[model samples]
Target: MKRLLLLALMLAPVPLAAQDMASAPGGTLRFLDKVTGRVQDLSLSRGQSVALGRLTVQLDECRFPRDNPAADAQAHVTVVDTTATRPMFTGWMLASSPALSAMDHPRYDIWVLSCDSGFVAPEVTEPEEDPDAPLEEINEG
Candidate 1:
């Protein structure tokens, strides 16, 4: 039954990655969009509330490798705000990994703010008329 247990472990979902923020169950946090890797965190004035439209996210789940409990692999994260209606936007995100080496907490909700003059909302592109067109665009050419 060793094979059976191994199969069970392989099929199980990563439970740690599926947790939601508890303190503010439905609320969103505001902060600099450091998650997007474009805006600088220091530039964001703390304790300032700002309007928002889109959110970027990055998550890394912690896990251990077989035969090596000391060596663990942490989750990864990156979030983008395509619906950037406002030039800047930010919301709270959950922190998952504590005491890990990261710029921010694994599951802490931080505001993601983006500020750029050219960061205007783009018009939604329409699909082609071809009934048999591919599910996704293959070429913009």
Candidate 2:
């Protein structure tokens, strides 16, 4: 009887985090090319895909705290290696703690960066034009 109950539970369908996913207008992912030591950032919408190296990363959904986006962010993505016969990864990943649920690939590492409702520049900068700034003069000698 106990074995039967356990078997039933094991056979039952498991639900993904789709309901808990926070809806957003946009999503972004970052992938590290371990072989070349280069990082690539990809911006995508729901059901969008981007290719990095030999892997194709597809974003299913992205969400963030409505109150404070920076507080936390999560994304559902599917990663596939075009050269492989099976998928590399497919699941939800957190932005703050990527290592918690990360891809275990030898030459590729991918993670969620954020889920934005609209375009937000990742970096901010200001022009610098100090006339007194020091400049090194090259010596031909």
Candidate 3:
């Protein structure tokens, strides 16, 4: 009787606890060209797509932990080969672990870098030129 009860409990489905994630406006992705041994970082917003070499990468969404945004980042991406009719990869890619859900491409590799949330550019101010300063004449050869 005890064995039967234990077996029933073990067979019962257990629900997983979902983590609280916050959505970001955009995120950064890294692309690697295996042939040329070149790597580049691409910044893209949600629902944006960019062409790199023969592949087109589309960012569906980017999410991070609400409690600690920098702890981890996960981005839903869809990678399509321009020469192919169907998409090569479409799934969530984690920033901390790229190998977990990596795109299986021969020439190129794509992975999530970080999620950008409420990012603002710093203001640029030009230096004020002195009116009293004499300008030096340039000699054109």
Candidate 4:
């Protein structure tokens, strides 16, 4: 009877708590050329693809914790080798734990950096004063 009870408990499903995540418009990724020992960082938006050496990387989506955007960023990415018919890698890669779902390429290594929350401000440029136009004089009080 004790063995049966223990078996039942072991077979029971454990409840898991779900974390709240926010999807960002884009994310940054790092790539390394293993042969040359060169590393490069690539920033890509969702559905955008970039070519590096013989591989092309495409970011499908990026997600981060709602409370902390910098913590635990995960991105769905697909990597294709131009010379090959099949994709070399396609899956979600966690920024904190890259080995959890790392690409299996011998010549290259790729990993997620962070999700871009669209917080970067655009550059504001003031219009140049017309060279030929008359300037308005301000009256000093």
Candidate 5:
């Protein structure tokens, strides 16, 4: 009887965790720009990637219906600089373009994820290292 009770409890449906849900691209398409040059950006669903010139592209602002917003939006996209003899900083590390702003306002909260793997599509949002609010104090006293 104890075993059966445990099994029943285990079988009970657990409440689903709140995930950042967004829409995925239905198909793939080539991303392009006149001044920047050809881009290999492909959208398997209905999301968009922001390209900062030809050097870098931030694959964020995924508009897929089923995706984790926090994860998807915060993907890192680092584009290497081709012609820097001694570059101090990495090329286009976080090219956040805020693509959602261009799309319909209602879907701003949506996140894009890979239709196959279900991972966040690309760079959409990132962690804020330095916030405007003051940090909590820890006095030695």
Candidate 6:
């Protein structure tokens, strides 16, 4: 009877606050190349993949709170290596706490940086020609 009660309790569903969280439109991931001791940042859309050293990191999805984007960002990714038949890491990784769900590779480390939803690239406008400045001499000679 005690074992049955324990089993029932273990099977009970745990409630989560995930419904309150909003999904990010896109995200950026940071990776550390253990061999070169260099850190690199990679930007990727959902389902996009980038090469990191000998491994390929693919961003699956990203999510964050609509009201507090910086507070926490979560990303689902899959890291594959050419040398290995199986993927090194494939799961959700949190930006605030990367160690919580980190890549288990020896040569590379990856973590989530931020979610870029509604991000607008800054516009570049050529400076207005100085109307008062003298024009350069023509070099037709």
List RMSD in Å for every model shown. Answer: 17.9, 11.9, 11.4, 10.2, 17.3, 12.4
Predicted candidate 2 versus true structure: per-residue lDDT over 1-141, tens digit per residue: 999999999999999654343589668898888878998889998998887768899999888876565657899989999988988899999998999999999888999998975545478768787889888799998
Comparison by TM-score, 2 against 6, better one: 6
lDDT of 3 by residue, 22-106 (tens): 9999999999999999999999999999999889999999999887777689999999998999999999999999999999988
Clashing pairs in 4: none
Stretches off by above 4 angstroms in model 3 are: 7-16, 119-141
- What's the best-to-worst order under TM-score? 4, 3, 6, 2, 5, 1
For candidate 4, give the lDDT of residue 30: 98
- Answer with 3 or 5, whichever has the higher TM-score: 3
Per-residue lDDT over 9-100 for candidate 5, one digit per residue giving the tens place of the 0 to 100 score: 99999998865545433323234444445445445432343433323333432332353333333222222234434321222111134353
Per-model TM values vs. the true structure: 0.19, 0.67, 0.75, 0.77, 0.24, 0.69
**Stronger candidate by lDDT (1 vs 6):** 6
Error of 4 at 120 (Å): 7.1
lDDT value, residue 74 of candidate 1: 30
Q: How accurate is candidate 2 locally (lDDT)?
A: 0.85
| Error of model 5, residue 83, in angstroms | 0.8
User: 1-141 in candidate 1: lDDT tens per residue?
Assistant: 999999999999877754221111111223444455443242222232233235444322222233332232232233445554432212322233323323344323343222211223568999658887666758977
State which candidate, 1 or 5, has the greater lDDT. 5
Model 5 Cα shift for residue 81 (angstroms): 1.7
In Å, residue 64's CA in model 3 sits off its true spot by 0.9
Error of 5 at 34 (Å): 2.9
lDDT (tens digit, per residue) of candidate 6 on 8-30: 99999998765467777678999
- Predicted structure with the largest lDDT when compared to the true one: 4
Task: State residue 68's C-alpha deviation in candidate 3, in Å.
Answer: 1.0
Stretches off by above 4 angstroms in model 2 are 1-21, 119-141
User: What is each predicted model's overall lDDT from 0 to 1?
Assistant: 0.35, 0.85, 0.93, 0.94, 0.37, 0.85
State residue 32's C-alpha deviation in candidate 3, in Å.
Answer: 0.2
Report the C-alpha displacement of residue 105, candidate 3, in angstroms. Answer: 0.6
